[model samples]
Target: MAPENTPVHIIQLIKEITGFIQKGSPITYLGCPLYIGRQRIIYYSDLVAKVMKKISGWQSKILSVGGRATLIKHVLQSISIHNMAAISPPKTTIQYMKRVIADFLWGWDKEKKKISLGILGNS
Candidate 1:
């Protein structure tokens, strides 16, 4: 691919990563420390951390190609757009369409099950 197109590809990857994080199923759930004894939050934080690490590793790789800073900037910009799209209405609706397409290409429950197993341990 052309050097200029690298930024666009990185942006698209960021968008995909954001959507995956926001809508992906919880990996684990534990009752709240207080409040309802059964309240739980998605264990997505770990997944996010892993993605960050991957990006950092990718950044190192990009540095060798001399596109490190530009790629990082583009990825961040795309993540901002994706974060907004994931929360708001019209954009969120569009993401749903994208998710449908992605699901068709990659099995619907594949990532969900993988993440769940990673977090919940073998039980």
Candidate 2:
């Protein structure tokens, strides 16, 4: 990789320390992509793509509402929670995920009518 704009002192210090290569922008620290700017759209683009992929999958649409809810819970929560613990995701990203999950739980076209909680056997 070409030389980055990292400080000369830090670079020299890193050079002094063994096995410390400089890492540049747009790095993934712990499975979550870290960007320099605070643009939620770009930062969450890969995540959104993954969600859209899951939504477009045949298995995603075929599951019943309960099953879809279960699967979606797994999809939205797992990695996000871990990433959130490390890096605070923007509020918009959280809202966007909620929207994605809602759209997935129902049909994207949203043709399904509302039903009571009791009918779904939830208390």
Candidate 3:
């Protein structure tokens, strides 16, 4: 893709020669955002939503602590590995993912208790 100010005729000529379709910015390629300019949390917001959805889906079940930990280690971590390998996500995204995982692991609704960051790190 060309820059924003690139001439339309040039783009057409390139497309005609290369036979590659032109698409607008902010497109997703391989589950990652492909866009011009600086990277922002907006681009990775979907990743957070996806993790939240996956965790929230299992909230109805009465899972043991081991089951929850296993899900977090295998499923929740796997979802973000693909995107994380490609780009540096914002701090907020990482923090949100951690919070969701921790909440799911410790049974947030029933106990309504908090886990310290140190305990989380050891686990």
Model 1: lDDT equals 0.38
TM-score of each: 0.26, 0.62, 0.70
Between candidates 1 and 3, which one is better according to lDDT?
A: 3
The top-ranked prediction according to TM-score is: 3
Lowest lDDT 10-residue stretch of candidate 3: 114-123
lDDT tens per residue, model 3, 22-118: 7766788888888789888788877888888898789635898778878887888889899989987887778877877887787677556766444
Model 3 stretches with alpha carbons more than 4 Å out = 1-24, 110-112, 116-123
Judge candidate 3 against the unseen true structure and give its global Cα lDDT, from 0 to 1: 0.79
Q: List where candidate 2 sits over 4 angstroms from the true fold.
A: 4-24, 37-40, 58-61, 110-123
| TM-score of model 1 vs. true structure | 0.26
User: Each candidate: what lDDT?
Assistant: 0.38, 0.67, 0.79
| Candidate structures ordered by lDDT, highest first | 3, 2, 1
